[model samples]
Target: MTVLVTGGAGYIGSHMVHALVDSGERVVVLDNLSTGFAWALPAAATLVEGDTGDEVLVSRLIAEHAVEAIVHFAASIVVPDSVADPLGYYRNNTVNSRNVIACAVKGGVKRFVFSSTAAVYGNPDAVPVAEDAPLSPMSPYGSSKLMTEIMLRDAGLAHGLGHVILRYFNVAGADPQARTGQSTRNATHLIKVAVETALGLREKMAVFGTDYPTPDGTCVRDYIHVADLIAAHMDALRHLRGGGASATLNCGYGHGFSVLEVIETVKRVAGVDFPVELAPRRPGDPAAIVASSEKARALLGWQPRFDDLDTIVAHALAWQRKISAEGR
Candidate 1:
C-alpha cells in the first residue's frame, strides 16, 4: 500500500518519511517547501512539490499513486506568529486542512492520520491533560488545529474514512541516525533555540516569563522526542489500517520540564553555559501544558524510548552541530 505524506519534507514529517521507507512501504511526499527542505526527505520517497490546498494537484497525486493513507503535517505552527496573523493560521491550518481532507475522502483514501497539537487544551486546569479534556485553545494556531479535528470527525462520520488524530505536545529532539531533524530557519521551538545557543549559533537565548506559577517560575512543557512522536504515529497508522476504529489520542511523555530545567540540561549535555536572558511572556503562551497520553498507550501500544530531558537535548544539540558542520 502507498502512503501519502503532506509536508513530508518538514522536521517531523521527514522523520515519518524515513520510517515509512525503511519499513519497505511506498511513500509519496507532497510539500510546498515553505518551511521545509526537499533534501530532508529520503530519496526513496517520491517528492512532489505542491500545496496541500491545491485540490487538483492533491487529487491527481492520490489517484495516480494509489494512495491508501495520508498523514498531514503542513501548517503554520509558531504560536507567536499565529497570534500576529490569526487569519493566516486559519487559512493554512484550518481551510487548507479542509481541502486536504476533502481530497482524501473524494479519492477514496482508506486511512488518514492528522497532526494535531496539545495547544488545543490551552491552559489546562490540571497537568497531564487527557484527550477528552475541554477544548479551549488560547491561540489561533491551536484553534486552527482543533477546527481541523472537528472537520475530520464530521467527514469520517459522513463518509467511510478512518482517521487517527494525534494531538502532540512540545515535540523536540532529532532522528537517532542523524538523518533528519528540526532544521527550520528561525525556528521558535524552545529546545531548538537552546541547542542553537549551546552551539554558539546564537549569542544567547531568552527565557520567556520567569513569574509563572511553576517551580522555576518559567513555562513547563512536556517535551517528547521526535522519534518517539513518530513511533506513536506509526502505531496509530497500524491501528487504523487494522480495522481499528477512528480515535483522537494525545502523544506525549506524561511529564514536563521547566524552561530553566531544559536550559540547564542543554548546558550539561553540550558542556556549554549558554547565556540566557529573562523576557516577558509572548501572547497566547500557556504557563504549562503536558499530556496524559494514557489513551495512546492503551489503544496504540506506543512505547517511548527517549523520554529523558538530557537525551532529548543531546539529540537536538547533535543535529544542530551536524547542520553547522555541513554549513546548512
Candidate 2:
C-alpha cells in the first residue's frame, strides 16, 4: 500500500515525503507546482503534476498507486491573502479539499491526515488554546480549513474513513540535513522574512501590529519546527492504520514567542542587525495564539525533538545560507 501525499513538493509536504521514503514506504506526490518546486522531492517519490481539484487525475493516481492513505497539504495558506481573496481561498482550500476527500472515499483510501492550521481558533479568550477551543475563525484561510475538517468528519462517520486533523501552529525551520526547507520566494511567514532581512535578501522587515494585547505588544505564535510537525503526521498515520479513532489535535511546542522576540532571535542567529520598521496591524491577524498539544502527545505519543526557538532559527539560517549560495 502506498501513501498519496498531496502538495508533497511544498515545504512541509516535502519534509513529510522525505520521512516517508526514508522509512521505506511507497510514496506518490500530487502537486500543481504553483508554490511547490519539483526539485524539493526525492527521486523515490513519484511526482504527478496537477491540481487536487482535478478529480479524474486524482482518482487515477489513487487507483494506479494502490494508495491506502493520503496526507493532504495542498492549500492557499496566507491570512492576509485570504482576506483579500476569500473566494479564491474557499475554492482552493475548501472546494478542492472536498474533491480530494471524495476521491479518497471513492478510491477506497483508508487513512487521511489533514494539514490544518491554528488560525481556526481565532483570537481565543485564553492562551494555550486546546483542541476544544472555540471554532470561530477570523480569516478565510482558517474558515476554509475548518470547512474541510467538517467534510472529513462527515465523510468518516458516513463511510468509515479513518482520519486525523492536526491543527498546526506557526511551522518554521528546515530539515536538519538541509534536504528541504521553506523555499517559497514570496512567503509571508514571519521567521522566513526576518531571516531574509538579516541575510540581506530583503532591505528590511516590518513588525505588523505592535498594539496587540500581549506582553511585548506584538502578536505571539507557537513556532514548531517543520521536522516536529512531520513527526506528528507520521504518528497520526500510525494511529489511523492501527484502527484508532479519528481525532483533531493541535501540533505545537506548547509555548510561544512574540514577533519582536522572534526577530531578535533571527538577528542573533544570523549575527546581523537588519533595519526594522513598525507597521500597523495586518487584516485577519490575531493578537496571540499558542497551542495545548497534550491531546496529540497523549493520543499519538508524539515527542518533539526541536522545541527551542534559537535552535529553530539556527536551522533556518543554515538553510537560507545554502539556498542563497546555490541561487535558489
Candidate 3:
C-alpha cells in the first residue's frame, strides 16, 4: 500500500514527503506545480504533476498506487488573498477538497490526514483555543478549510473513512537537515519574510498591524517547527491505520510569540539587522490565536523536539542560506 500526498512539492507538504519516504513508506505525490517545485521531492517518491480537484486523475492514482491513505495539503492558503478572492478560494480549497474526499471514499482509501488551520477560530474569544472552540472564520481561507472539515466529518460517518483533522497553528522552520523548507516565492509567512530580510534577499520586511493588542502590539502566533508538524501528520496516519476513531486535534506548542519577538529572533539567529516597517493590518488576519494542543499530545502522542523559538529560526535561516547559495 502507498500513501498519496497532495501538494507534496510545496513547503510543508514536501517535508511530509521526506519524512514518509525516510520511514520507507511508499509515497505518491500529486501537485500542480503552481507554487511547488519538482526538485524539492526525493527520488524515492514519485511525483504526478496534476491538480487535486480532478477527481478522475485522483481516482486513477488511488487505483494505480494501491493507495490506502491520503495526506492532503493542497489548497490556497494566503489569508489576504482569500479575502480578496473568496470565490477562488472556495473553488480551490473547498470544492477541490470535496472532490478529493469523494475520490477517497469511492477508491476505498480508509485513512485520511487533513491539513487544517487555526484561522478557523477567527480571533478566538480566548487564548489557547482548543478543538471545541467556536468556528468563526475571519477569512475565506479559513472558511474554506472549515467547510472541508465538515465534509470530512460527514464522509467519515457515512463512508466509514477513518480520518484525522490537524488544525495547525503557525508552521515554521525547515526540515532540520536543510533538505526542504519554505521556498515559495513571495511568501507571506512572518518568519519567512523576516529571514529573507535578514539574508538581504528582501530590502525590508513589513510588520503587519502593530496595534493588534498583543504585548508588543503585533499579532502573536504559535510557531511550530515544520519537522514537528510533519511528525504530527505521521502520528495521525498511525492513529487512523490502527483503527482509532476519527479525531480533530490542534497542533501547536500551547504558547505564542508576537511578530516583533519572531523578527528579533530571526535577526539574532542570523546575526544581522534589517529594516522593518510597520503597516496596517491585512484583512482576514486575527489578532492572536494560540493552540491548546493537549489533545494532540495525549491522542497522537506528539512530542515536539524543536519547540524552541531560536532553534526554529536557526533552521529557517540555514535553509534560506542554502537556497540563496544555490540561486534557487
Candidate 4:
C-alpha cells in the first residue's frame, strides 16, 4: 500500500517522505515545487512533480501507485501573506483541499491525515488549549485549515473515511539525521527566522510584538520539535489503519516559550549575538498559544524526546548552517 504524500518535497513533507520510504512503506510524492525543492526528496521514493488540485493527475497517480492513504501537506502557509491576499488563500488552501479530498474518496482511499494548525483556536484564553477549545480563527490561513477540517468531518459521515486532523503548533527544527530540513527562501516561522539571522543569511529578525499580557510581554508558543510532530502523524496513520475511529489531535509539548527566550537560545547555541529588533505586534498575532497534548499522549501514545528549546534550536541551526555552506 503506497502512501500518497502531497508536498513531499517541502520541509516537513520531505521528512515525512524520508520516514515513510525508510520504514518500508511504498511512497509516491506529488510536489509542485512552488515552495518545495526536488532535490530535497529522497531518491528511493517515487516523485511526481504535480499539483494536488489537479484532479485528473491525482486520480491517475492514485490508481497507478495503489495509494491506500494520503498525508496532505500541500498548501500556502504564510500568516501575513494570507492576510494580504485572502482570495489566494481560499483558492489554494480551501478549494484545492476540496479537490484533494474528492480525489481521495473517488479513488477509494480510506485513511487520511490532514495537517491542521493551532491558529484555529485564535488567541486562546487558556494557557494550554485543549482539544475542545473555541474555533475562532484570526487569519485567512487559519480559516482555510479549519474549513478543511469541517470538510473532512462531513466527508467522513457519508463516506467510510478514517481521518485524523493533527492541529499543529509552531513546528520547527530539522531531521535528526540531517537528511532534509526547512529550506524555504523567506520563511516566517520564528525559529527559522532566528536561525537564518544566526547564519548571517539575514542581518537580523524582529520579535513580532512586545506588549502582550504575558509576563515576557511577547508572543509565547508551544514549540514542538518537527520530528516529534511527525511521530504523531505516524501514530495517527497506524491507528486509522488498525480500524480506529476518526480523531482530531493537538501536536505540541504543552509548554510555552517566549520569543525572546528562543532568540537567546539561538544566540547561545550559535555562540553569536546577532542584533534583535523590537517591533510593533503584527496583526493577527496572538499573545500566547500553547497546546494541551494529553489527548495525543493518551490516544496516540506519543512522548516527545526533544522537547527542549535548545535542542530544537540546535537542530535548526545545523540545518541553516548546511544551507549556508551550500550558499543557497
lDDT per prediction?
Answer: 0.94, 0.96, 0.95, 0.91
* Better-scoring candidate (lDDT), 2 or 3: 2
Off by over 4 Å in 4: none
TM-score of each: 0.99, 0.99, 0.99, 0.99
Candidate 1 lDDT, 198-285, residue by residue in tens:
8888999999899999988999999999999999999999999899999999999999999999898888899878789999989998
lDDT of 3 at 309: 97
Q: How far out, in Å, is residue 288 in model 2?
A: 0.7
Backbone-clash count (model 4) = 0
TM-score of decoy 1: 0.99
Stretches of model 1 off by over 4 angstroms after superposition: none
Candidate 3 per-residue lDDT, tens place, 56-115, comes to 999999999999999999999999999899999999999999999999999999999999
Write down the worst ten-residue block by lDDT for model 4. Answer: 319-328
- lDDT of each residue in 213-310, candidate 2, tens digit only: 99999999999999999999999999999999999999999899999999999988888899999999999999999999999999999999999999
RMSD value for candidate 2: 0.5
Candidates ranked by lDDT: 2, 3, 1, 4
- Evaluate model 4: give its lDDT: 0.91
In model 2, the Cα lDDT at residue 112 comes to 97
Q: Clash number for every model? A: 0, 0, 0, 0
Tens-digit lDDT string for candidate 4 (1-328): 7999998999889988888877899999999999998888788888899888899999999999999999999999998899999899989889999999999999999999999999999999787999899888999999999999999999988898889999999999999888889999989999999999988889989988889998889999899999998898888998999998999999999999899988989999999989999999887778899999999999888888899888999999888888779876
